[model samples]
Target: MTIPAPLNGVVPPVCTPLTPDSEVDTASLVALVDHLLEAGVDGLFVLGSTSEVAFLPDAHRRLVVETVTRHVAGQVPVLAGVIDTATLRVVRHAETALAAGADALVATAPFYTRTHPAEIAEHFRLIARRTGAPLFAYDLPVSVHSKLGAELVLELAAEGVLAGLKDSSGDEGGFRSVVLGARSRADVDGFSVLTGSELTVDSALAMGAAGVVPGLGNVDPAGYVRLHRLCVAGEWALARAEQERLCGLFGMVGVGDPARMGRSSSALGAFKAALYLRGVIACPLTAAPQLPLSASEVAAVGKYLAAAGLL
Candidate 1:
């Protein structure tokens, strides 16, 4: 499935706002969508890692998708995240996103099972076939150990079972392999690659990627969108400057600790905190457990944002 042009550029897997009671604050969530769009993001990736898809129930996920889609009204693509550990649940959620008028599916492989490539290829092949929509493989091995092997990824693309892969696998070699392999098939149409690592944005673009899917975009949409535009316009030096500035921000927002309390509990919540400081979201709470930043971290992060001119 080809991406609608409006869907490119810095899209954030936007954070979900919650009520004081910690339910899916529907009104705040809707307002958050408006905020992200107003922030000049190209699209919304609801129910993604930043949205804490793992803890979100199917009903809440669908509601989130429906609300974001209705909120956007097709003005921009809404790539709903489907991180089901089970392929059937993946299928279920993928179909739900399509039914909700979403434009694509950002899927991860069987994380719980740590499935092999052949298994992953089959899983995504079936998921893509079932949904009849474009699939962007979310290949980050941080949450789970084995990942979608690049060879199998290209093989799936060759077989027409997938559209693109978001290479958060975090191995520069793997990212290089994905780009080199896909660009080799330039003779074919509709094959693309999106980088998931914010640190690798410049490198990925130079290595022949379609674009990036960095979490940094969650906070600095304008900055990274300018970086992307600069890269597109052949201004690599200027682009790298923005990339580095945004890269500095990622260190804080990308942190995850097994031991933490308060609102900024996880990387996802930290990202929402950045968005909160930037006024992109109405609140900085996740749907479950909730990620709250430490008081000191709040001040520290605020200082950095001011220094970056993001605040």
Candidate 2:
């Protein structure tokens, strides 16, 4: 299926369910896909931060893209993350994702090595030139350590070097600047501006964002879908109510003890725990190096689910 130019609506960063040995849980993945499709998500984003892309080996990453793209079968567009530390490596991942049938690719600015702004721009330009596939810049300063400025994003969009942007930088002002800039420029038509902030979907959409790529959408796709609809319908009051409910559920990301695990471990564990309790996946185990949640932490996730009426 062809991806919508300005992709709209709720697009969840699909979680990569893992086996006990940390292999890709294909069966669980397919089930998770069904869960999202049943809830009517506008698109699917796999191998993203929520999916624990950083820890997965190349083979595992390919398996994820293959499993999801094959299972989804084009019912909705599947955007795969081609995140790596540099240009050529990212280009290689992009090729693999494209070969595995991903409809679009999401990548970040080069990381690990400090790159000049010119280098970053050329990084994207090189990937676009090499792959010739629709590319969305993943603006995650927290992880990549390089911020994609609104000016550069607009310049790329205008030049067709980038098709869209997934802003997860948590800078609402910067995000709004990209949104407004994209809309104001006639040459930047069909350039999607998606917010990755689970807490600010309503505000982002209100400010003319194209859609959302919420990680929490994995646990509550229907909630985000409903919130998106309400916002689109101009029902701000109702949207806020729904957003608040989801916001409450978002608290589950903190179930793991900070003293025991890092934020990634806690948040990913919480998501997988929620999925397991919901019976969407067989196991709640995250990838290696990321600590698994304790029974008590899993129980805490259950509490959040119950509070959100999800369980």
Candidate 3:
């Protein structure tokens, strides 16, 4: 299916639920997909940072895309993240995901190596040439260590080499520049610019972002959907209130003790725990080498859910 020219609305980066043995739990995954779809989300993005795609093996990643795409059954676009360290590796993942029924692909810049902006541009261009599918640039400097510049993104978008961008770099100024540039440039009319910021979604949308790809949406899809609706309806005051409420609910990401685990472990762990508490998924286990939330941390997530009326 053709990805919407300007893919808009709330598209959550769906988490990959795992069994106690660290295998992809198909049932839990199906339930999680249904949970989001029922919440009125516009799309599903799998194998993203929130999905622990960096930690998943190739086989597991394939299973996730295949499972989600087949189960979604075209209800909404399913975008698979081709997150890898470099060009060739990303190409391989892109091929696999497309074969597995993904409608489009999202990719980050090369990691584990110091790369120039030109090389990053070439990397995306190469993937676009090879995949022949809708490709979105995932700007995640925190993970990739390379911030995609607004000028470069605009150049690529105008060239029709990039269908969209998902900015998670946390640089609001740069994001605003891209949002405005994409809007003013006639050559990039169909370029969809999405923000991956849960905390600043309303502002991003107000600045002309096409959509949001919030990781927090995995835990509270309805809340994010409501926030997006309010923004689209131009209910700025109510949208700010809803966004602030979600920001408060987002504090669950801090429940895990940082001394005991890394940020990914804590944030992703909190999300899964919340899902489990909400009965969306069966288990809260993340992939290996990541610490699971303790009992207290799980209880803390429960409290956040209750406070947000999610429980």
Candidate 4:
């Protein structure tokens, strides 16, 4: 299926389900996809940060893209994350993902080594030229260690180098600038501006964002879908209420003790735990090196689920 130029609605960055031995759990992954699709998500993003892409090896990443794309079977657009530290490596991943049936690709700036803005632009340009597929810029400065400024993004969009943006930079002002800039430019049509923020879906949609890519959506896809519809229908009051309820549910991400684990562990573990508790996935185990949530932490996640009526 061709992705809409401005892919809209809730597009959840899917969580990778793992077996006890840390291998990809194919069955559970399919079940998780069914859960999101049933809840009305517009698309699926596999091999993203939420999917533990940084930890998975190249083979496993390809498995994820192939599995999700084959399972989805044209139901919705499957966007694979071609994230790497340099241009050539990213191009290789993009090739694998497209060969695995991914409809489009999402990528971030090259990282681990310092890069200049002009070099970053060239990085994207090289990828676009090499892949010849629709590419969306993933502005995740926290992870990539470099920001994709609004001007650079606009220039790329105007030049047809980037098809859209998944803004996870947490800069509301910069995000607003991109949304407004895209609107005012006649040469930038079909440029999607999606927010990756879980807490501000309503605000982002209110400001002309095309959609959302919330990690929390893996736990409650219906909630984000409902929130998106309410906003699209212009029901601000109802949308705000739904967004607030989702905000409360999102508190589950902090259930893991900070002293023992990093935010990635806490957040990703909580998401998987909720999926397990909700019986979507069989196990809540994250990939290796990331600490697992304690039993008490899992219980805390249950409490948040209970409060949100998910359990």
Best by lDDT: 4
Clashing pairs in 3: none
lDDT tens readout by residue for model 3, 1-311: 77999899999999999999999999999999999999999999999999999999999999999999999999999999999999999999999999999999999999999999999999999999999999999999988899999999999999888999999999999999999999998887889999999999999999999999999999889989999999999999999999999999999999989888999999999999999999988889999899999999999999999999999
What does candidate 3 score on TM? Answer: 0.99
What is the C-alpha lDDT profile of model 1 across 10-90, one tens digit per residue?
Answer: 677777777656668788778777766776777677887767777777778888888888878877778888887868988
Question: Which runs of model 4 end up more than 4 angstroms from their true locations?
Answer: none
Task: Judge candidate 4 at residue 73 and give its lDDT.
Answer: 98
Q: Please give, for residues 247-278, the per-residue lDDT of candidate 2 as tens digits.
A: 99999999889998999999999999999999
- For lDDT, candidate 1 versus 4, the one ahead is 4
Please give each candidate's TM-score.
Answer: 0.90, 0.99, 0.99, 0.99
* Candidate with better lDDT, 1 vs 2: 2
> Which residue ranges in model 1 land beyond 4 Å of their true spot?
5-8, 186-188, 254-266
At residue 55, candidate 1 shows an lDDT of: 76
> Rank by lDDT, descending?
4, 2, 3, 1
